[model samples]
Target: MTQLTTIVISNVKAADETDLCISIQNMRLLRILSIKVTNEEETLQMDALSSPPPNLQKLLLTRKLEKVPQWFCSLQSLTYLYLHWSRLEEDLLPHIAALPHLGRLKLTNAYVGKQLRFGTGFLKLTVLWICNFPQLDEIIIEKEVMPNLKSLWIDSCMELKIVPMGIEYLQNLQQLDLTSASRELKNRIRNVDILKVQHIPKRYIWK
Candidate 1:
């Protein structure tokens, strides 16, 4: 009834089959769906999102999800997505990129699968966030796509080495937060408001 522009379910141990069935049953009259999960063990008979509301515009999910099944990337009307806390196949990232209306994305703790041929074109996104992934070496930003990003959060990623060659390519990037890092790969973070770990003085008093 709210046009349901957004819906997020967080830490609902009670998010059982009935809840899933009812949510989808509810989506027929809504526009968005989100779930913050601790596990992906919902009963299949009820949690079939392979074909969703068909009118959804935003779908946000976070926390402890496994590899994203391909059915998710096939949504033609989905324009915004947020997937966090899993080892996402790299190849699938590009598949999500192909959603014709996809516009914004936020990925954290993902494994970006074996298939790497995808493009950032699907998101031509205006905002992005990636955090705490141990395998990320560098983020590859292509100039021809994603020029509208306004904010990016890349944090707690131990293996992340650098932020590619054209840090300046994202012309509109405004707020960038890079924190809790033990190693760094870039000397300057272009022309943006960014925080580097070593540069900030430690706040605690130590003997």
Candidate 2:
């Protein structure tokens, strides 16, 4: 198992956390790890993974996490990450932005905050997706953050009534997609915020 590079666990149960952690710790070569907990009552106890795979490049977790793990700061090789139903109340952007090699990120119903701010440090990130954020009202992207970002998708954020603050700073942004957004948001984008995303080569907006 030490030579294993990928592992996918479906229907994960609370009782399996201990064994799962032991198995993952032994897989030093693991590059991809995906865990899905189908039952809402089941908790993965992710912190048990004290020694996560050092070289993991992709990770997908479909479960509820009260908070992002402190160990996540150690995944230097991580490039792709997907989180669903975490329902964390904290602003997750700061914790994951420090990842030096993260290129793609997808969040679905992961946060319960009013705003998500992207400060500096996503040097290699190119793609980002934010979806199913029922309470999110704003996203702030700082001037130099995500300099290489190429594609951005924001869907099902009904309360987000304005374009992301400082989106105009992403000179490399090529595509922008908005789906199931508020009518005011779509109107603001087409009328008031048009200049903010004018440089983007592709734009799609759907109510």
Candidate 3:
């Protein structure tokens, strides 16, 4: 187990948190860890894992979390992260933005916030996907943030009124995908924001 590089645990129960943490603590070489809880309403207490695998690169978690775990700040090597059904109501970007090597991030039904603002950091990110955000109405991507981003996908965010603010700053963006987005929002992008995304080589919008 100490040499394990990847572990995927599905249908995890809340009762197994302790033993799971203990097992993870022993996997010093673990690089990929994915855990999907059996009950979406159950929150896994991962803070007990005092020393997380320092070399972890990809983490996918599907569970209910009251807040972003404090331990996430230690994943300096993480490049890809997927969070589903976290249902958090607070600003989550601040906790993970400082990850120097992070390149891809996917959030599906993970937050209930009204706005998501990417002010700085994420210098190496190349792909970002935001989906199923029930209450999200706005996303602000400031200049100099995620400068290397090449693809952006927004899906099922019905309340989002317009394209991300400062999206034109991403001169390197090559693709944009919108699925199940409101028609008005789509029209806004095609009509009012045409100049903002004209540089993007590929744009896919679906009703």
Residues 1-207, model 1: lDDT tens digits: 335655666654434646664566556655787766545542122234445676778876655444455467657787777766655543446667667777677776656432222245744566666666676665666655666666666666656655444445656666666665534443344322134322322212111
Candidate 3 residue-wise lDDT, 58-93, digit = tens: 999997876787788889999999998888876789
Please state the error at residue 34 of candidate 3 in Å.
0.5
In model 1, where is the ten-residue run with the lowest total lDDT?
198-207
In order, candidate lDDTs are 0.56, 0.89, 0.90
TM-score of each: 0.67, 0.96, 0.96
- Poorest stretch of ten by lDDT in candidate 3: 40-49
Runs of candidate 2 with Cα error greater than 4 angstroms are none
Q: What clash pairs does model 1 have?
A: 88-111, 89-112, 89-113, 90-112, 90-113, 91-115, 97-122
Q: Look at candidate 1 and tell me the lDDT of residue 205.
A: 12
Q: Per-residue error at 182 for model 3, in Å?
A: 0.9
Off by over 4 Å in 3: none
